[model samples]
Target: MSTELLAVRPDRSLTDGEAALLLELLPPERRERLLWQAEQREPLCAYGLLLLALRRRLGWRSLPPVARGPAGKPFFPDFPEVHWNLSHTAGAVLAGVSDRPLGVDIERFRPVTPRLLRRLGADSAEEALGRWVRLEALAKQSGTGVIAVLNRGLTAAEEASAHDLTVFPGCAAAVVLGEGEAPGQVRIWTLEALLEGLAENF
Candidate 1:
């Protein structure tokens, strides 16, 4: 199964007007769900990144209808074979799609203090940050929220399935794919490029 990833820097996140245009492309239900967070830029920008990746990798002309899993994770019902997940942090936003199920997470790359390590229940600074993103990806892959996986350790199989990502300069990211599947490098897009994509005929 091929897995594709895309990441955007927070510096390049969309403006309200650009987000509104992407928002119009969503199905009514999804659009309604986002209206409440109209002031929140990350989700809108992250979702727009998802659509951009879908169009590029899957050759999708128009977005397929979206459905939510029990945990409120969105999926393409008509494209059940297609799996995807989105994530964002203070540093960057990411989108991933694959033929098999996948989950992704990105976190700002900041120094972790001993206190922070204690809070994360990890041994070292790097371990703390690494585990943080791992648990997030696993939770997302399982359709379980991040809270459910917080403080959780990776099993042997999980360790093998997860891959570290180096997309944005100030971010640490991770992605979980089908057990034993390899996650390749990401496709980085500038905000201007994504905006250009939005201007394309759908």
Candidate 2:
């Protein structure tokens, strides 16, 4: 099964009208979750935009109903053949789509606390963040969340199976695919391209 990963850096130049247009396309649940803060809103909108793009790519007639897994991971309930996961941080949002199970995580750079480092069992801040995203991505891949995996930790075999994705500077991202599945090419989407795609598809 092929996997496609898309990343977008939130555009600060979007006009109020354009923002409304995008917001209108989001489901009521997603639209209501929009934050008053621009920083928060950008990544959320990016997630919605990515969902629209993925739907079009898969030739879905409309946005499918999303259901939460037992561990809080989201999935398309009616589209069992399509698997996807989304993650967003301060300045970037990431989405991964595949024919089989997959998960993706992105985290912006920040100094790690000594307490957090110890909790993550990492020697340094960078290592802690890397390990954090990997563990989180792995949890997502299994339809579980980080809290669950942190409690149990990954098995040795699970540790050996994840793929670390190349991301822009100042951030870390990782993608985890089902065992034996290879990740396909990474795609970086421009804000214009995403907006254009939405206009065409919607």
Best by TM-score: 2
The estimated TM-scores of all candidates read 0.86, 0.87
Q: Mind sharing the TM-score for model 2?
A: 0.87
Q: After superposition, how far is residue 12 of candidate 1 from its true place, in Å?
A: 4.9
Q: Pick the candidate with the highest lDDT.
A: 1
Candidate 1 structure, TM-score to reference: 0.86
Candidate 1 local lDDT, 62-131, one digit each (tens):
5778899999878989989988899987747899988888999888867898877987878876778887
Clashes of each: 0, 0
- Give lDDT tens digits, candidate 2, residues 52-105: 657767665345666787878877778778888888887688888888887888
Give the Å error, residue 201, model 2. Answer: 2.7
